[model samples]
Target: MSYKKVSLIVLGSEAALKRALITVIIGGDEAAKSSYLKESEIYENNNYKIIYTPDLNKPSKDIKSVFVYNKDHDRSLLVVKEGFSTGEVWKQIEELHKLTGKSTEEFIVVLPLIHEHTESYPFTCLKISNLFSTISKMAEDRRQKATSTSHADHPDDPMKVAGKPSDSRVNLVLLGMSGSGKSASGNTILGKTIFPSKASSSPVTAECQAEDKEIGSSWVRVIDTPDIFDDDINDFTKKQHVNKCKELSEHGSTVYLLVMHVSRFTDGERNILRKLGEAFGSKVHEQTLILFTRENDLMQGDMTQGAFIHSLTPDLKKIVTKCDNRCVWFENKAPSSGQVERLMHVVHQMLIFRNNSAGSWWRFSR
Candidate 1:
């Protein structure tokens, strides 16, 4: 498709932004491109133009500016900073979807990287296919007459919809019972040793700590928090941790990974459900997923992790089933641990499923 006007959204202001409509806003290392730019080997390609910026306030002046995605028939993708809020950001999308006047499914909104991935960003192909495919479909849907494709009209592109989701950020959180490898899981997700944690410890996490990151070309933030029910603390301390978790999770918590130890099921683990009920609600359990830690447990015993769960007491089975049986195992025993992308993919799917659900649709319809 011939295009005259195309905008790329970026997180910062730059000389390169004048050429695009928006700057999909990947927040890692645009300045360091000098290494490759010196060699004239800068890898810059995308289905949609990208304006590079360090923040959201600096998109180009001419193209429409939307801080959030909201509407009907609003067929566009939104690239956001890590830890984006579906509840907070969806207003713009809800508004745009209303404009499209189509079922929520007819127009799709996707957050490709749930966090900032520096190792693979700026020049990486991570999840870009799905992201671009949505834009391509939008462009196809809005394709105009083939005869007059001029700068004045800016060839009828469907991806040129009023508002779209941003792809510049990722949101990942670490949650599990005390001593269930929550901190290590966080470190693994972040690809750094940012937090202090140990296995088989009680109440190591006192509060939530967040660190921004770049996963490849995407921005990600990991928030590691205190154990679900730290018995060591008083009720006041408990409320504080609970409040902090809620505050931190206010945005872009696409999945609730209830990390549990494969070898043992403790009251601490059961307490997590009650705390989740308070933090997010009983419904949160339905959205919650089980992440089994300690890979060695599987190898150390005849009863494999899967078999152990299978032989669980009826109550445990019910508990697992309530969480939709969405579980994955991670061996955090080593760095570059298991199931990072798989975990992210699960979160991504949950966010998409959440968007398509009735609560979101009703907001637009109402």
Candidate 2:
């Protein structure tokens, strides 16, 4: 008895598959070229051939070989071939699945996008290696997501899950007066020019907005709130914005950054800490850190940061003491990663202190 080799039936029109095949063959070495020809021949003869069909065609004979479908139809097997130099492959896969409006199988593979002009083996190997790395990372992410979802579906406790929280996210809320560099501070924290900042008497950020970013094993979620305590804004609107900030804090622990300009300290700021305690709980001071913007002013005055902060006005010093002397300075004109890193260090310390202290929760007004 003789056995015939099984060929893969790619789910696509013969013409389309052929064009893709030619592209790949032209880009590969002699060995890969020969393999392509052999695979193509197998598709030509149904005897031991691969089949290329636009749809899943019903056949009289039983073909036990692998069939590649052009589009995912909730199939058990899938091989996603993608080639792009930029963006994320994981994101692209998700987008395609959503665009198709179909649930896809977990069994998947990703092939690199081959360049037709490339002939060097070293370059080709590097490309293949990158593709495999991306696929592996995607697989690991999927596994973690599945595990988390499983635990979420079957909760063992009312307040917490059985396992430790997998989220390594930190929420930083920017709170300050109008034109106090709060919006600019938000952009600095996020390392992006998202929040609009300009010279205006009115608040630049009228509503609470959030942006997320990752920083070395931790995800930093930056929330920019309006000048809620501004006298110009009514109590009703202030409460609404405050509530929005609280909502964003639901997913993770919160660190409030009370932004203030280095050069400009208005009368309103004199009672800011007291008002903050009234708005949030009395313990709000523990979660709040004073962030002084416009470090350039200190430089211009030829004053060291420590001396400048130490020489703050009586009211400002009192507010800093209320926050346990936790403060950071940023140059809104020249934002730097160093400033952000220093701030994150302070944030990390606060989180540790909170975790260690019992019955210490971020005080957010209901």
Candidate 3:
């Protein structure tokens, strides 16, 4: 099937969606043959072919492999078994488009059943029954509209409408050695005291905590994690922390803020990135930004942030270089909204660079 003529449906509940797909494809009376092919992960009959998969974010290779067979059938349905936040769902849609070399209309997003009525979704969502006909009609309407209008006048380009950076959300995960002012920097980003911040020889934040605030047209979720890279932390405990961070960051695009004390780049922090790789995946640095707290120390010494970065030791400079020199300093003691805004701008630009580099349609502006 031509991708331009495909229909995308975002609906509620995986089980419900699957049931509906079976009913539509295999007939409600044909219970004897209503079973998914175990090896191929597909359910098909003479009329329709349905491809089933888990969440899109977790398996790029699998998604790509599945799409290799999508073009064989005219009425194919790609059913995603879980749903993400509105921004994340759109991102997945864009990714699906890129992976399949297709348009947004070629995918179907099945949200978790629990969230059917709780939140406002970015795409037009529907309940389970009569999915095929409903999606077919919608796709036909869109196709007719596209044919009648100029390319610029087509109203259903998902990238143009839903993939704007302003319409998306981001998760800022704070990670670094203990006493690196992660909690304080989190408070600065949030523009209030949400995470606990205080001076002590021991760690203040005993666990991962998250909070969010609206900053103009977007929402920024700040996730403050305890020192998972600490040498003394046991493997089991470290795993727990890492898992918590992942769970909290599961809903949106995550930018890890590697918080550090501006004046103190200790021996422990020298290999922090390596340790971070071991905990998270090796691609952690791709989404990492260096956040230096205690900027007042730099101010007192009349040192610019660039000057400070230029003078970093080889070890610290390697960390900065690995993150593409995307670094920002914060004065947590005297927080300001401008600091947070500037940080978010860097984040926006960073995402834009990544998406554009990957040939994505999502765009961002200052």
Candidate 4:
């Protein structure tokens, strides 16, 4: 994972560079056929992919033509043979910049394992043996730079101004079958009727809707989504809803509120958690909180939340356990704000525990 995708420009004999590359790839001194080199100019293994060229003057106009760079690797390398002057190295780098239209900072200058050059240049210099570590360091620097630039560009971001890491913002995503009162729960969380909530035999809120509000001095984004888990829906339409939910929840720590009716658990919801995992990822349960709406019904039945949960069917209890028993009941129609405050308290505690246990909190997989 440390190795980056690199475009190496070797200013030395092709044979010497090829030998070095083979050693780096296979990680041994044992000799092997040069057929791998004859096959293509690109050499790769699990750890790294190297697109190399010896002729600096005829470097590819588009590096992508040589090898398609992936998300993890976008750095370049300049391999200087022994006896090359620092001036010559800079000149070659400039030529490379002219040819590839890449900034000199994107290229890491690599010197021979044993060299006498003590003059420092504008680019980072590393021994050939340490090329992988050098590229990893460069990648880390690039990531840090991008983060800093993002903060600078978005100075008005609520999380930034609140002195919290941007990723610490909480995204409360309401998910369940249709008619599960997800929109009502969303309104309860935001303490306002942001999404349309009504008693309907058919689905309401046909698409994903999101609204943001400050909760406990932290910005919380609440997303009310359509019935993405509906078996009757077409695959394409369901995928569209799922993708939209992911897009809205991309920037923050996403906590899926699996809303359900306290009095009624439908057959479709028997496998709701599994369906969510299938749509998102298996780790989705770790960030999920089971939300049972219509708390008045349970109160009317004179059953405590703990007693009700204890009486849950085997399958339903399994889903609850999957979320580590993080359950909150809401009486959306009630005038009291205690229920909403309690929900926020649970969410805040979950966020704090997750942040403490895991260095980085949950993020949607795009």
Q: Whose lDDT is greatest here?
A: 4
Q: For residues 1-366, could you state the per-residue lDDT of candidate 1 as single tens digits?
A: 453222333221223322121222221223323222111211133323332333323332312222132222132333433344555445544543464443334323333332323342221122332443334444444444332455453224312322222233345557766788888887877777888887543467777887765443234667787775666667787777767866765654445777788878886566667767776667877567777788667777765544666676676676677765556667787644326655654554445445333222111011
Model 2 per-residue lDDT tens digits across residues 1-366: 122322333332134333343222121112222123223322322112333333222331211222222232222212223333323433433443454443333323223322222332211122222332333344345445545343345354322333325354688999999888988888887777989889997667888998777653356788998887778778888788888888877777788999998898899988887778777778898898889998998999998766776688898888877786777789877887667766775676576545343112211100
lDDT by residue for model 3 (1-366), tens = 222433222122244454444443333233233323222344443233445554444456655665564555343343434335677667766767787686776455533222335576554454322243454445555545655353454244222332334335688999998899999999988888999889999999999998877553346789999999888989999999999999987776789999999899899999999998998889889889899899999999998765787798999989988887777779988886567756775676566456333211111100
Q: Higher-lDDT candidate among 1 and 4?
A: 4
C-alpha lDDT (0 to 100) for residue 309 of candidate 3 = 73
Candidate 4 structure quality by residue, lDDT tens digits, 215-284:
6445789999999888999999989999999998899778899999988888999888888998999989
TM-score-best of 3 and 4: 4
Let me know the TM-score candidate 2 reaches against the reference structure. Answer: 0.53
The predicted structure with the larger lDDT, 2 or 3, is 3
TM-score, model 4 to reference? 0.54
Error of 2 at 170 (Å): 0.8
TM-score for each predicted model, relative to the true structure: 0.50, 0.53, 0.53, 0.54
Lowest summed lDDT window (length 10), candidate 2: 357-366
Kindly report which residue stretches of model 2 are placed more than 4 angstroms away from their true locations once superposed: 1-167, 355-366
TM-score-wise, the better of 2 and 4 is 4
- Superposed on all Cα atoms, the candidates' RMSDs to the truth, in angstroms, are 18.5, 21.0, 18.5, 20.2
